[model samples]
Target: MNHEFSVAEVMTTQGGTMCQYTEMTDAARKRVRAMHNWRRSQLALGNVQNGRNNYNCSQAANMYKMKYDCDLEKSALDYAKQCTLTPSVAYNQGENVHVGPLENDKTKAIATVGEKCTHWSTVIRSSEKKGYPGKTVNSTFFQAVKAWWGQIFRNGVNQRMIFLQNLRDKPNAPIAWSQMAWALSTRIGCAVVNCQSNTFTVCRYRQE
Candidate 1:
């Protein structure tokens, strides 16, 4: 006698395979929990925390029994094997990328969720030209400069005088030049101005 099955029949037979594998995985989890409980019990009985120490041989015997009965090592090996045999479609079903925001600012981190940026420099340059006020960069730079020097000084003695002097020779400086000056000053750790005519002087926290 010869036996053959149609494609639909074969698919129907294989449909239950996933349920079976799921049951096996559940069984492995149960075994892991049981072994963990047994280990906890042994540790509770004044046994040393070391796994290899043989000071309490009876507890060791219990551990060995649990290990063998649950076949924890073998179960782990089987689970790994199942992972390797997972269908590509199933494996890729829920694949997604997650990006996190910058540390201090919730609104300003450049987070690429799925694809890596290939031309980050161009992106940054465009943003700068477009006057994108990145919150994270602005906040961190502001805090660093504020901690090192007091407030941003716009008067004659401040570094802005020198920057404006240099810009005076160049073509029309952008309206954002002052903003750029502030950013540059923050970067170079110079945000304080000294007053020579006053007895009481304001000082900033020096954060060298």
Candidate 2:
């Protein structure tokens, strides 16, 4: 897939202003939820590795199982439709977005019901881009959420007495992961939209 991104907003095409919308189907949503819970279960079971060195990370004592929320999906879709790089989710919600060229033939019918439109491949070539070094990019929406959960590799549970508080002060704090594991955040919602030649994905988590 191409790394070059499109500057055209989801609301406007290169030729004119218009909006095209596509949404996740029931099957897609179920798969997304399964992906999330499976990754979280890995951490809860201490079966995760650090992206930095493939080192083993400690486990979570009580990672909550996540549920899909249509309200959050609506909120995420509301922002995703804009297809902006900047995050503007509600103050009490956490958000993650990915933008890139739509290349995989499977994703071409992303708007169609029951289409196999999940997962893609990419490489994260810079630690500077992601605040840590890694060979693979979390190209799937579920993998994107898993990336947030991966902060344990860098900011382990023993880092501080109040980890999340200290983490927020860091230059490249893992806010997404923190939110993902925010014990109280039991709900999530996500959406994907095609903007001409690019794909925009956004996910929202309930925040405490």
Mark the regions of model 2 whose C-alpha exceeds 4 Å error after superposition.
1-22, 50-55, 103-143, 146-162, 169-172
Model 1 misplaced stretches (Cα beyond 4 Å): 1-25, 48-79, 82-208
Residues 116-204 of candidate 2: C-alpha lDDT, one tens digit per residue: 01112111111112121111112345444545566656655432213445546665565555555555568877765544445556667
What TM-score number comes out for model 2?
Answer: 0.61
Worst 10-residue lDDT window for candidate 2 reads 115-124
List the global CA lDDT of all models: 0.21, 0.50
TM-score (all chains, Cα) for each model: 0.17, 0.61
Most accurate candidate by TM-score:
2
RMSD of each: 31.2, 10.8
